[model samples]
Target: MKLSDLAESQILKAQAEGQFDKLKGAGKPLNLTADGGSAEAIGFRIMAEAGAVPREIDLQKAVQEQALVLKETEGEDARKRELKKLADLQMRLEMEREARRRFFGE
Candidate 1:
């Protein structure tokens, strides 16, 4: 094989073997509190700005229907609110995944 092909194969092999796993950006050990909001809030804000959610509710009804239902013991009202939020998030995630698939023609 050519040198380029050999190098590519070695890189792929190392990736498959998890040799590069430690290089992943797992972030700092310290919980730096310089930011005003939580990391999760920042991430969600980015996702929202990127138009991750479907514009129409009908387009996401199928995904929302499959969202997990919280137990009754968790307090019906609170559970209901959480479940609704989870369903909305799930539907948005599903829409984003579909958009990515279409973009990549996967």
Candidate 2:
């Protein structure tokens, strides 16, 4: 059999054996022959070698995470504002106490 046929057969065998379980890093180029001149054959061989292309995202999980992140962001902002308001009130009270003490000489 030709080298192309052998590579094709190996790919099929791998697929049948559940060996092409992932395509994460399979986008890298592959050389199936020594001379490496058959572009079309190499492309086909790579496609067959990598059973299926990897997906970019899991839509449901991505949406849920985005919503959770937004919720945490808003919550943090609210907490920050509350803390600033409390600090301002405390400073004002301290100033008022100081002014009263100065007036009363205590």
Candidate 3:
């Protein structure tokens, strides 16, 4: 059989086996905003729901977490390391944000 046919058969078999029966938000409406944004917004929502955020967003999250840890840290060396990490994440996030803004003119 052709490759597409084989892929379809595999997907059908998985469905028959209930492999996708208990996914998160399985029966809930998607939490998309009603602002009628671009298709890119829809794709971003889907990717976020799947825990696949863009690098800038991910870096921002990391920076937040690192800030929390830095606050709780007590040792001098550890604090320095955490500070360096936070700075690096912040720089990367800035770069990614600028790139996205340039590409999308946003």
Q: Residues 49-80, candidate 1, lDDT per residue (tens digit)?
A: 44554343334554455453444337878877
What is the alpha-carbon RMSD of candidate 3 to the true structure? 7.1
Q: Which stretches of candidate 3 lie above 4 Å from their native place?
A: 1-43
* C-alpha lDDT values of all predictions: 0.58, 0.56, 0.80
Cα error, candidate 2, residue 97 (Å): 0.3
Residue 40 alpha-carbon offset, candidate 3, angstroms: 6.3
Residue 28 of model 2 has an lDDT of: 61
RMSD of candidate 2 to true structure, Å? 25.9
Clashing pairs in 2: none
Task: Return the top candidate by lDDT.
Answer: 3
Between candidates 1 and 3, the lDDT winner: 3
What TM value does model 1 have? 0.34
User: In candidate 2, what are the lDDT values of residues 1-106, reduced to their tens digit?
Assistant: 9766897998899889977666644556565564276654554455555553212123334445544554555577776765565555556556655764575477
Give the per-residue lDDT digits (tens) of candidate 3, residues 1-106.
9766896998799789986577566678655665256566765665686676988778888999999999999999999999999899899999998998877678
Error (Å) of candidate 1 at residue 19 is 25
Find the 10 residues in a row with the least total lDDT in model 2: 52-61
